[model samples]
Target: MKHFLSINSCSSQELLELLELSIDLKKLYKSNKRVLCLAGKSLAMIFEKPSLRTRMSFQVAMTNLGGASVYVKPEDVGGIGKREPLKDMARILSGYVDGIMVRTFAHETATGLAEYASVPVINALTDWSHPCQAMADIMTAKEHFGKIEGLKFAFIGDGNNVARSLAFGCAKLGMRIEIASPAGYELDKGSIERANAIKPGTVVQSSDPIQAVKDADLIYTDTWVSMGQEEEKAKRINDFQGFQVNMDMLKAAASHVRVMHCLPAYRGYEITDEVCECENSIIFLEAENRLHFQRALLKKLMSSN
Candidate 1:
């Protein structure tokens, strides 16, 4: 069995195939294709942290494909490696569910689940990466722009999980990405190095958002602080003060620029309502793609040999 815990798990061909499948499924949906495609398959999702988008999107994707979900909140799932060992739980759950997904604090946790489980383990989120979100973002790019490579994408704001995944994935598909973040809030150095190793000249990280945005076709931004970083919210807000993506920043990019956000945004903080509501704002479309992307991913990972 194969798993999709990270973008690196599959070759460039497999990645492209998944994107093509998303496109096909989307066209089918537009033609009123109904009923779940993966009716009998089940995905056991375990979230150590709470979420709105990940949970809802995955559940809906499963239901839309003729499948069902069994959500295991942190407590319900033994709080992850507490009530029993991770491997033990993995051994047990793999037998019951067709696949497993865990949104935990460490990226290693997802890897551990995949290591122990006999079934595929998807990474809904791990502190270090968001492979699924990257899929949707890329799918949107393919749907709108018709290609991923050679397009310049500037990610302005916090360089967190989404940034890491996007950096790796864009590199895999031959896209040039610039990450502009505050000095202390920059993307993981490891992710940058890994992306460079995957494809030379694929990723560049810096602290200058405006410079990164210049000549870029796509402008992407995320929240100043992540879900678990609430304790440092005040500090992050001050640190990311000039990093906000408003109209001024959008106009700094190319005339054909399109805006994207993973959503659950802060109205006037990292992004202003004016920008998210703009004609170029494809943020909602990106959000909606989360479901289609997951459907395609589930279809691939759950497919039996």
Candidate 2:
């Protein structure tokens, strides 16, 4: 079965194809056309973490593609790893649904679901990676910049799943990606290795945000403290003191640099309100692309299988 657990799970060529489909899908949607590619199909969405974009996008994506979706709330499932075996739940869901999309705190839970599910399983969001978010991000960048290759993408903040996924996707597509994070918060070793393998010397890890965004065409930042890290919020806020992407940081980037944040942003923390609301920010467009990109992803993953 095919699964989208990480950006590296798909080859460079496959990622390009998915991006192309996403662009085509966006065009189609804007033209007021209806696509019934997944007619009579259904997707089972399992969410362990509450979200606005992830949930709404996937549900709307299914609806746009003529597929119905059933949302399984976090409490309804009794937590996959504890109440019931992940493998057992995966098997059961696979029998009834055409596909499964899961958002969880643990990366292993997402992987475990894919292991036993007969149908394709997509990692909606996990601690280790957010592949769907990465796809939308790439689609947004490509739409704005006219191309993906050779663009300098810079990520500033904790090297969490969003950073890892964005770096992995950019590197795979031949774009230069640099990440600036505080000490001990670098991107995952596995993700770094995979990106390096795809495009040698394409990923740069730095502690200096100024140097990272020196020539960047795109600047990305996410919340410093993610779900399950609420206890360490104070320390994280202290550690990420100078990592904020404000107007000063934009001055160091390219003249046409675009700022992005995977929302629920701590306005004054990881980024400033002035920067997010500025004319150069494509944050809202990036968020909206999730719906279109996931629509293409669902069709690609389910229609083929």
Candidate 3:
């Protein structure tokens, strides 16, 4: 993989390979075996948008792979696209680091970095997509189900970046994705179309939470209000009144259906505390697999061509 800016950047076969690699790495980690695929590499991590999971996961992933990471705080580079052009920073970082991983507000910042960098660029997160999170989510599902094909995955809440990436990634992997969001918060039409092109009739969108979660093998939800949208909190709360993934919603899904959240969860809002703390919740497992999946991705992107 040259870059991992978006799930669409990878083919279905490539995603499966990454998932398999993640499984192997996870087993090795569990067995206390050292697998240093990126023995001598160095990754430069840039955080335009701060995150606990993104920062810790990538840092631990690099260390586990026998490599090191340099954390570039937001102020260090004057915040990407603020002090200078993303291309210039990308060019400069490529000369020093083996690979670049950046979490930014704009998706184009990631694209801009990839355009100029000589090394691989990974999009840790952006306003338009969070591909890394999608990878970890898929990895968690595959771990439970043994395979992801033909599984019904339902996302209930704001159709934000996480939801968008999940839709794209799930559809590409032959999993049908049903997303239920408020009218104004639906997944971008273009993204839905693109996903449909990959797996016809796999991407389904609705405004009803029941329709989205009905018989789904996995139920997912994310915060209705994201980092930069604090001003819309009250309005969003009112808009998403019945969208919470509570126990009642879980009952609509399969008996053994799993629950997933991408983290920094606001309990009683997007998801209730009951559901999040339930036996079916794999949220922590999903969070932990972020390290393994990302370690595999870093190894693939930085260790070789």
Candidate 4:
């Protein structure tokens, strides 16, 4: 656990331990208990993509832990890996910060940073995976359902970063995940194979949203148009026509099914306003859990003990 790069990089025990820590932190936070585990630490956050949750969650998590964060944009550093080598930047930043967190377009940038830096590097989000978001998501599901293993999880949308990470998380935790996506938007073969390798028969893919949600314990979705894909917005909207998670999709799922969405949700697009505000939706709770999970993660990565 040197670097929180991807869910696939973590063992089941590590994932569960982080979740347990997150739960404990959440309880302490609600009770107004002061947690200063990383009191003297500093985190450096580098961003190549625009963000809301990723930026706020890591910054607030550091604040809650009695630590501080420094936000770095591409222009601030003369463009990451363009003006200077990634290894050189990684080494320089590691000398100043206790940890590094990056939200970038290429997955290699995060991994490359981890390779050269002595401090832990966390993948805030990449075009390929969103491990932190998945951690918070699983925490929300566990808090709601009382457990995660053996749960039937269904993901309906582009088989993008969120869906990929969720599949890996569910597979590692012994939950079965089914992803429903339109043709050409399905989860990549390598990702599916890796997830199934973690837990045999853990990931199932399909084209029909209704079939994927059948008797599912949790239904998840993300925006069809992700950051950097603005050019394809119109085509994505048309291609994902029947893929929206609405009342009709919920009606097909189990009676106890809960809904989750990684935020910055597009109302009337990936999900409807009705479903976003429904009783079954834990979207807001899921968002809040991001802070808790990242707090636990920072403490684990930066604390002396």
Candidate 5:
């Protein structure tokens, strides 16, 4: 729990504890109770990749907790490790801010910041993983179903960062996760093996989207063309033709199956416009949980107690 780098970095108990804390914080907020656990604390947010949710959620989470956040773009710090080493920036920021949150392209960048910072460092988003998003997603599922364990979660899209992080989170939380992707876009063997090690038989991989969602309680998807993959947009669309989560795919899933997507969704692409607005979609709730989950995370990581 020292740093929120990856879901695998946390034990099962820690993950459960975070979920509990997130629920408690969410309740307090909804009840109009003022939470000032991080009073006088400051967070430094570094963005190597542009984000709407990640940026707003962390900043607003800190504000909600009676704290402040400073947004640092690439040019603001001379490009994280360009003019100065990551260690230097980490050490320097630690002196000023109680915590650091970074949304970057390389996974190593986050780890590098944590390596030198005296304060806690959170991985807002990395090319290899999106731990916060996965945690919030689990929270959303728990809220919807009143529980999470033993649920069948199917991820039908690119086996990208979101899929990998969900696999790790689900394995730790006793949920079965099946990831479906095209041949070249499948989750890496090492990640699948690592997730399975946490809870044997928890992670399953498939090439058939329809078969993957069979009997699934939750079906998830993400954009096929991510930030750096824009050049491959046309090719990705062609490769992921049959992978879109439409009404037909939902029909194949369990009757109570709910849909989720990390936002900035491309309608008629990875998911259909109808599906995005459908009764089964909890995408907006999933997005809102990001604020709640990060508030709990900030309290956990920054509180002196």
Candidate 6:
């Protein structure tokens, strides 16, 4: 069984293939082809954290592929990898499900599950990486731009998992990313250094959003405060104080620039509603691509015959 735990788990060529696959799937759906490629196959989704998009999109994706997904809450199973040990849980889940997806706080928890499970284990969302969302975002970029390389994108806000994956994706594809964050909120030095090492000239770090986005093609940002960091929310708000993607900042980029966000957006915080619903915003299209990307992902993981 193959697993998708991080962006680095896939090569640049494979990432492009996923983008193409997602486009193909969207076309197929429009042509009245509801693919059930995984018919009779079952997947178990273990959630150590809460979600809206991750849960809905994956479940719907499995169903669209003619498969079913069973949701497993922490309390339902001795609190996931703790009550009976991670390896033991993996061994148990592998028996009944064709695949497993876990959303949790730790990256190692997903890696541990992948290590022990005979079935494919997916990282739905972890504190350290968000490969699936990046996959969808890149697909959006491909559809919107009609090309991937040579695109100058900028990510402005907290350097969370989303930003890390986006930076990796851009670097791997020979594109440039200008990331701007408050002093201490920059992308994990480790993740940035690794992406830079792989594709040296493609990643740039900045402290000013305007400078980061100078003539950028795709402008991006994420919520100022991430999940499980409620205690730091107030502090983050104060620190990220003039950083929202409003009209003034949008005009700072190129005339053809498009804005994107992985939603559940805090309106006045990370971005303004004016930008979210702007005609230039492909944000909704990006959200829709999540379904197609998961369809392609499931087809890839379960078609390992």
Q: Candidate 1 at residue 134, lDDT?
A: 90
Question: TM-score of the candidate numbered 3?
Answer: 0.98
- lDDT (CA) for every model shown? 0.87, 0.90, 0.91, 0.93, 0.94, 0.88
Q: Which residues of candidate 1, in runs, are more than 4 Å off?
A: 35-37
Residue pairs of candidate 4 with colliding backbone atoms: none
lDDT of 1 by residue, 190-287 (tens): 87998999998888988889999997889999888787899999999999988999999988888788999987899899999999999989999999
- Taking all chains together, the TM-score of candidate 2 against the true structure is 0.97
User: Comparing candidate 1 with candidate 3, which one achieves the higher lDDT?
Assistant: 3
Question: Could you tell me every candidate's TM-score relative to the true structure?
Answer: 0.96, 0.97, 0.98, 0.99, 0.99, 0.97
lDDT of 5: 0.94
lDDT by residue for model 5 (6-91), tens: 99899999999999999999999999997898899999999989999999999999999999999998899888889999999999
Model 3 regions more than 4 Å off = none
Question: What TM-score does prediction 4 earn?
Answer: 0.99
- Model 3: lDDT equals 0.91
Instruction: Answer with 1 or 4, whichever has the higher lDDT.
Output: 4
> Which lDDT tens digits does candidate 2 get at residues 103-185?
99889998899889999899999988998998898899999989988988889988888888887887789888899999989
Residue-level lDDT tens digits of model 3 in 1-305: 79999998889888999999999989988999977878888999998788999999999999998999999989999878779987889899998989999898999999999999999999999999899999999999999999888888899988889888998897789888899988899999999999999888988889999988887999999998899999999999999999999999988878899999998999989999999999999999999999999989998888753
In model 2, what lDDT does residue 282 have? 98
1 versus 6: better lDDT goes to: 6
Expressed as tens digits, the lDDT of each residue in 1-305 for candidate 4 is 89999999999999999999999999999999968888879999999997888889899999999999999988998888999999999999999999999999999999999999999999999999999999999999999999998988899999999989999998999898899999999999999999998788999999999999987999999998988899999999999999999999899888899999998999999899999999999999999999999999998888976
Clashing pairs in 3: none
- Check candidate 1 and list the clashing pairs: 36-64, 36-65, 36-66, 37-65, 39-66
How much lDDT does candidate 6 score?
0.88
